[model samples]
Target chain A: QTVSPKPSRLGLCAACHGETGVAVMPGAPNLAGQRLDYLRAALKHYRDGSRDVPVMRAAIGPLSDAELDAVARWYSVQIPAAAKL
Target chain B: QTVSPKPSRLGLCAACHGETGVAVMPGAPNLAGQRLDYLRAALKHYRDGSRDVPVMRAAIGPLSDAELDAVARWYSVQIPAAAKL
Candidate 1:
């Protein structure tokens, strides 16, 4: 049997979150090189309503555990932003 | 004469976008290493209604040019994410 690449749970996130995860929209935060723990916790907050953005809450609430893990892992390993302008 | 440190136009972005521009929230893209032009255009789109998100439109529409420039400049210079996890 062949293995297929896991689909990104990012959904419409690419509209603002670029293919590499850099934010494409204003007010959207960068996600390239953030710490893993922080990323995970923030997602949990969104899902649990600790953070209250309608878009984020709806988007995060439906994600499965595996999808959440994939998002965290993908970002944790992303290329850090270049230090130079 | 004195100059004040330019405040980040990122506003509440710090809640999800870390101080360094790395994303602290899942599904949010990394903004640390993105191209300058892409960043600026996206903001414009948000403001011009090309991108239709209540959070983004509201945020981008209220910003002044200087504030927009500051945000672009800040992300343009953010440290890229590290290669290793």
Candidate 2:
């Protein structure tokens, strides 16, 4: 679990959400230190189109459940962006 | 800004998301210390039905813009559940 996420995983999300869980793109929410179950559920919903954000749906569409879980966990364990303030 | 939320505001969210932002309901996500902007966006979405969770939509249905912001801000400043763990 300590292993870094695969480049493919971070590569796609980092375009908007940043490499270390902070969101780099405007209006993108920081994923760092989010709740694991919550992130997991969100990812699943995005992938399945239940949540229906086109960018998020497309971004996670190709991923398997394991990949989603891994990415979600990675973001969940990172230090939150707000913790610095 | 430091004034506590009106009892009506907390009363609805507190049924599942606890008074201090932790979730008392099993499936409810912890809201404490979540990003302020993110929470604001989520509250708006829940109110408007774009995010489409029936329970959340109904719970926030009666709130005004100011009330939603007040509640979101209250949750955003509280300590995170994970931080306590």
Q: Residue by residue across A38-71, what tens digits does model 2's lDDT show?
A: 8887887787777778999888878777777878
Error of 1 at A29 (Å): 1.1
In model 1, where do residues sit more than 4 Å from their true spots?
A: A1-6, A82-85, B1-76, B81-85
lDDT (Cα atoms) of all candidates against the true structure: 0.61, 0.73
Query: Against the correct fold, how does model 2 do in TM-score?
Result: 0.77
Summing lDDT over every window of 10 consecutive residues in candidate 2 chain A, give the lowest-scoring window. Answer: A76-85
What is the DockQ for all candidates, taken in turn? 0.15, 0.35
Q: How far out, in Å, is residue A52 in model 1?
A: 1.0
DockQ, candidate 2, comes to 0.35
Residue A80 lDDT, candidate 2, scale 0-100: 59
lDDT of 1 by residue, A1-85 (tens): 2222434776555466654566777656555555677678777767776555578777767788788878766655555543232
Interface RMSD, in order shown: 8.5, 3.1
What's the lDDT of the predicted structure labeled candidate 1? Answer: 0.61
